[model samples]
Target: MQTRTALSLVAIAALTACASQPMRAPFSQADLPAAVQVPAGHTVVMETAAAGDITYQCRAKKDMAGQFEWVFVGPDAGLKDRSGKVIGKYYGPPATWENNDGSKVTATQLAVAPNGAANIPLQLVKANPAMGMGAMQGVSYIQRVATVSGIAPASTCAKANEGANQLVRYTADYIFYKAM
Candidate 1:
């Protein structure tokens, strides 16, 4: 019947429209803590889900003899796209993000807010000028949000444990933005 064919065409057209539109980001800055929110005039250029471990070492607390604590060493993570394909890596003492194209960026911490008692804090960082080119070019800011379980070990850090290292598992969403 003509009516049935018309309805089928309408459905096909609707699906085509949706397929052609760019995908929207899964995150919303308005729902995030203010300290970690990216400033206006920037638009998301890339978003990645990072999974890996943070290394910490037990060391004497600064300015406080006879006390010890866990100090952050660095992070090592594989960055994945929304559908779970590894696109890059995140690592370093200098905190670097590198894409498959060999482009990279190192950023300075701007601010942080508590995520939860059992998780690492959400963070915002101002990106330094990118190195190389490709995906990292023009990146202005990077926000670490939706953190899970990156906190330092809760075990006692005593003189006996000095210099001992621990690797804590964590996952987070790293969203990179560029000036619009």
Candidate 2:
């Protein structure tokens, strides 16, 4: 019993320590790939570790035009920081970002690469026009990196489960960039 208590305390202390540190820039401007270009004079302002689910709704095949018999639509999820703070959210085809402080940025996919079978495709997202005065203020671009475990479960799309909302949990690094 005492050992268990000690272990729990240690874990809490570790989480608190991690949460206290300020977020850091993900990478230097020069390091950004051409597809992830930020405006001239812009640089990475903040980077947060996002841990959350990527919700998917199974849908039936539409005319059998694609290889997969069924399709999954959505990546909607609330995002959290390393210390487990609800900092933001992500959603939609024109993927959007909304932070706790009400900052919002709608993004367009500029590039993507497969991370893993159980992870959503990592992407470079360009902000339409970063708005608000919160953690996302002045943000012009975002990169979804180090993604894991958020892939849509295609197998769940059995005909009977069509239109069902399923959530696939995932984690990733979300780097925000802004004009200096």
Candidate 3:
């Protein structure tokens, strides 16, 4: 019908208008204060502390890279309850720096111990994202951790393997550094 065709055209137009665009820093170099310096790198090397299944830490450029780019490093832990064993293991945030550009990074890497790493692209970071509000006092905010399942295992299984094989929760911990 003519009505259907017209409606479809309108929808297409709207969608096209929303096409992705390049990111530009809201403020230029001059806009930033004199004291501000580009970050070096940030990473969270695995340390003590366990939540949900991941042990994570965050670091920034000053202590890492030479230039001002942010990087987050950590580990995610996965398990198979029934087997009392770990199905897979890794630690990295899909969105790192604890975040980016007033938010978090778009890429997440799920690294399996002894070698394997599962990379979640920046697009997904653009997809399932965090919401922010300034001066939101007394607000209860929450978020969900997206999973990168079934990573291929390495030839050598560590003590992490030994279980009855059961349903379990896997977790990735991100350690965010304040500087980056």
Candidate 4:
């Protein structure tokens, strides 16, 4: 009977220690490009994986008459937690991140660094004041990394296809940070 009680105590102590450990961040900023790294004085508050499409349209290149290329229109993605549960969405012309609770933030691009020729660039954005009072309440910065295949279509973008829209699927991890 005494042995059983001692074993129970040990098990409880182990569980307590585990519960006190801090949650590990999903990704390390050191592995990311400097231009896309979150600034100091901020701590990660949320991390989500975004999976969706980027819309691009064929348009005449500015100041380069007779030349046409694909221009980024915007993104439409579902933001999911590590377990793949749908939590929010990211979309826009104005570049918005919205939680299911109706809280949202619009942000301006701060910097971008190349990921690869076949992938879209990794980016950093400064979030504007959030609109509601949920998960985005104090978000200061958002980093878009781990990008996969959001590049423009490889097809010809001649004048014949002007205004044609193409959707390129992509997956990326968006890490949200707040002032510490």
Selected candidate, larger TM-score, 1 vs 3: 1
Per-candidate Cα lDDT values, in order, are 0.95, 0.72, 0.30, 0.94
lDDT of 3 by residue, 56-107 (tens): 2222235544323212233344322222333222335543222111332233
Q: Pick the lDDT winner.
A: 1
Model 4 lDDT tens row, 1-180: 999999999999999998998887556799887888888899988989999999999999999989999999999999998768999999999899999989999999999999999999999999999999999999999999999999999999999999999999999999999999
Q: Which regions of candidate 2 are displaced past 4 Å?
A: 1-41, 65-70, 81-85, 92-94, 154-156
Using TM-score as the measure, the top candidate is 1
Badly placed stretches (over 4 Å) of model 1 are 1-26
lDDT for position 96 in model 1:
99
Q: State each model's C-alpha RMSD to the native.
A: 5.4, 7.9, 19.1, 4.8
lDDT of 2: 0.72
The 10-residue segment of model 4 with minimum total lDDT is: 24-33
User: Model 3 segments beyond 4 Å from truth?
Assistant: 1-130, 134-150, 153-170
Sorted by TM-score (best first), the order is 1, 4, 2, 3
Off by over 4 Å in 4: 1-26
**Which residue pairs in model 1 clash with each other?**
none
For candidate 2, which ten residues in a row score worst on lDDT? 65-74
Prediction 1 TM-score vs. true: 0.87
Report the C-alpha lDDT of model 2 over 27-134, residue by residue, as the tens digit. Answer: 654544455455576676766777666667776566764323334455666777655687878776567778888888887778877766777776787778768878
